[model samples]
Target: MAQMNMIEAIRSALDVKLSQDPDVLIFGEDVGYFGGVFRCTAGLQEKHGLHRVFDTPIAEGGIVGAAVGMAAFGLRPCIEIQFADYIYPGYDQICSEAARMRYRSAGEFTSPLTIRTPVGGGIHGGQTHSQSPEALFTHIAGIKTIIPSNPYDAKGLLIKAIEDNDPVLFLEPKRLYNGPFEGDPNIPAVSWAGHELGEVPEGHYTIDFEKARLHTQGSALTIICYGTMVWVAEAAAKAAGIEADILDLRSLMPLDLDSIIKSVKKTGRCMVLHEATRTSGFGAELIAEIQEHCFYALEAPIVRVTGWDTPYPHALEWEYFPGKARVTKAITKMMEG
Candidate 1:
């Protein structure tokens, strides 16, 4: 196994899929000649040829619409939206067409399209570049929403999403692209060069869907989160000097309720964390589920440490982000109760 950042891991997954399955193709703006704005698709166009790994027009709607059409015709089109914030133009194609293909056709047709986009804030991308709209897609009736917290999981889960015969929204946390963020903007995030999670396999590997990755075992508290928040929660727990059991939800639609319930029951304290805004965020759904399943086991009110219910702040990003100070305070409060 070799150490790989999230970008390298994702590229490896795409490379393996393109080589193994001729039906698989990748296309998006700047993904061809420029190899994507983030260079995730660099060298892919030359390696797989223009037809297999090419670039698309700037029209997001047309991009997604074409993907839907290609998927129906027995091709696995792994399309990228460049940024999650720019995916709204293609929302109709994703929710209305690809998501409902199987249901509308009574299982006669299935839209196996994989939509990948970079999400979350870390590089001062401001409001436009750094919005976590994952909660929006998770609310849709059809389609699966996935967010992997590390390079290893990113490679495996991406491969799974690309192969599945359904609409899959793969939200890549931009904050964790090159390193693991520990909920602090002041401290530089360490690179994944020597980290265990950065060690990815060379060949094809698919992690099971709807499974939660448990970080640590502890009875003090259970911290449930996904994407970049998973690392932040662990850091918060360490800073607070409280042993916390953290669960990284790799997929949102097909949630791992069994793991959640077990953890909450054992800890008797739960907290949902996310970079998305507070109102109507994915944390709300997690809290609702925890309330329903572990109502009796709760010793304290389920705490939620999330971003404020406002647009991502450009000047005060750290204040808006639920950083270590915020998460640690929540942990302390939860423990006190």
Candidate 2:
């Protein structure tokens, strides 16, 4: 109903969740007084008080370890890693402890924690600060991975991640923090299955985690993407005059195979795009699944537009990152088939 930036929408979700649940708490470096590096957690400390929203030492491992401890004790803690690239310091705590705790303890314990991190390249943050590491966590069994493309989904999905009873890796694209993408915020937050939108309260609401939302419909080709790439693909579609059907994959794990298959069957041509490196990225997995189900329907080979194989570069950021030209080129090539 109201227009808000991606950052504001995220704060709204966190604010609503904190107000609704005493079990919910937030902790991360600079998240308290500094209000996070990107200010996504701004003013939360004042609203919830320092006890519930406080800063942790500059240790990703310790932050994750403490979150696991809190979740085990029946608290829902939302922890933020300053950047996705730096998440490696806490990888052990996440994969070994937060992820496997429930299975290892035979349901005697569980960690209902949401790990939020700003990810991807475009801001000249260089290799260390910008990395899309979703594939790494998606490989793990116990974690739910998500990357939202715009403000509405950013708010809805973050709320969903916080409420889920397992470790959720919530990756937000830094590039889209103040996006100018076009989408209907009031289009009714329906599940990917076409079910009624989860009734998020005036105070708060959580969208379903496994559903894919179709941003625009077309018959020529389907562009499957998440995070900022969704916006890129849409713009490319317009520039190329290709009427590409855009699907925002709101959830990475428990991917909406049905939506993808159905869309591919109709379009017959598909392109997978992301800001992650081309080699061994999520695009490959989506290609495999689509080929499995829609092979006969496909008119062309599945195409991908992604970053180069090298680390995200500061000097060559634009070249390294896929843009509308690259995406349009890929779309035109796919259309030729």
Candidate 3:
């Protein structure tokens, strides 16, 4: 085990896959020479050689289109989109080609590719760089969406995504890449070093997609969240003095419905939280599912605390963000009911 941040853990996962599998290829805007914009692949190209780990043009569509062809030719390509905000350019390729290759070809061809991109706010990136477009990807039928809140799941789930036979959209919360953000910009940021979730295996290991990890257990309420919101949910529960069952959904699609139902049923109340836009966000689907399954078991109506329907504000990042106060109030209200 090593005390590593999310960036280091991801780099380790790519390194392990590159060394173990000859078919694995890593490439993107700056993944090769620049070692990724966030430096997640810093030393990988130098160690793996240029062919396996290389850079590409700033064309998102061509990059994803080419990766689909490569995957068709039996090579597993793990490509990065620089930022999640820029993924729209390649959205068609991902949704049409890479996603449908296997099913369209009657199982003769498969797009075993991983698309990694940094997402979310808290770095003053404004609207251009700080968008959480996960719901768009999750809506696609053939894509598997995943978001990790810490170093451990980031490494393990990434390796698992790379090895999967279908297309995977791995969304990295840039805010949590170095440390966990508990929705408070006032408190000094805490590094992942020596943190419980920071200790990651340096070897090849894969975390199953449908399995969710329970962070805090309780009978009061169940908080279902992923990515940086996991930390925010934890903080909110503590502040509200609610012993909540907080579930970190490492894998968004192929969701662990059984686990969600179990937790919601046990608590009899639930809240869905995320950093994405409120309307038609992934939280809506979670709420719908929870209602369908846990309707009889539910006490209070399910609540969702999410980002606003408007674009991420440039000057009002914190206000747009579903912070601890918003979450704490929701929790208290649910508990009081």
Candidate 4:
């Protein structure tokens, strides 16, 4: 076992994949020489030659398009889109081409590529640098969505995503890149240097993306969340003195609905939490599915605590973000009734 931060764990995963599979390639803006904007790919270019790890122009479309072509030609290409907010320019290649490649070719062609990007707020990135768009990708078919909250899961799930047969959107919560955040701005940011979640495996590992991890088992209520919201929900539950079953939904697209239903049915209450906007976020789909399966078992209406339906604000970041106070209030309300 090795104690590594999220960035180091991710870089280690890429290093292992590149070394094990000759066909695996990594490329993105500043990923080669500078080692990525956040240094997730730091020193990888020096370890692995430019052929296996190189830099690309500031073109999201071309980056994803070329990855699709490479994957279809039997090479496993892993591309990075600096931030989740900048992925729109490559929407055509991702949603249209890479997503439909297998079905369009009648299973003759498959785009086995991984698209990694940083998502969510809490770093005062305003609107452009911070956005959680997992719902957009989840709405589309033929692709898997992933968001890991800790370094351990980050490394394991990333390795699995890279080896998967279909395209995977691996969204990393930048705020949690070094340490876990629980939506409390008062507390100083923590690093993974000495945290238990930072104790990651040294080599290759895989965490099933379709499985939901039960962080805490309780019967009062169930809290379902992913990414940065997982930590926030836990903090809220603790603050509210609520014994709730917390489930970390590592994968969003191939959602572990069975696990969600089981928890909801056992607890008799459910609250979906996410960092995305409230209207059409992935939390909506989660609530819908829970309602469909656990309606009879539900003791109260399914609740959701999400960001407001407005662009992420630079000055009013916390106001827009659904923080611990917001989540605690929602859980308290649910338990009251």
For residues 1-337, could you state the per-residue lDDT of candidate 3 as single tens digits? 9999999999999999999999999989989988998999999989999999999999999999999999999999999999999999899999999989888999999999999999999888889889999999889898899999999999999999999999999999999998999998888999998899999989989899999999889989999999999999999999999899999988889899999999999999999999999999999999999999999999999999999998999899999999888999999988888
TM-score to native of every candidate shown: 0.99, 0.93, 0.99, 0.99
Estimate, for each residue in 1-337, the C-alpha lDDT of model 4 and write its tens digit: 9999999999989999999999999999999989999998999889889898999999999999999999999999989999999999999999999999999999999999999999999999999988999999999999999999999999999999999999999999999998889898988988998888899999999999889999888889999999889899989999999899999999998999999999999999999998998898898899888888999998899999999999999999998888898999999888888
TM-score, candidate number 2:
0.93
For candidate 1, report its TM-score.
0.99
Q: In candidate 4, which residue ranges exceed 4 Å CA deviation?
A: none
Give Cα-based local distance difference scores for all models. 0.92, 0.86, 0.94, 0.93
Query: For candidate 1, lDDT tens digit of each residue in 1-337?
Result: 9889999999999999999999999999999878998878889989999999988889999999999999999999999999998999999999999999999999888899999999998778888998999889989988999999999999999999999999999999998999999878889668999999999999999998989999877889999999999989998999899998899988888899999999999999999999999999998999999999999999999999888898888998989888888999889877877
lDDT of 1 at 185: 86
Instruction: Report the lDDT tens digits of candidate 2 across residue range 41-113.
Output: 9999998899989999999999999999999999999999999999999999999999999999999999999
Global Cα lDDT for candidate 3: 0.94
Residue 54's lDDT within candidate 3 is 95
Q: Sort every candidate by lDDT, greatest first.
A: 3, 4, 1, 2
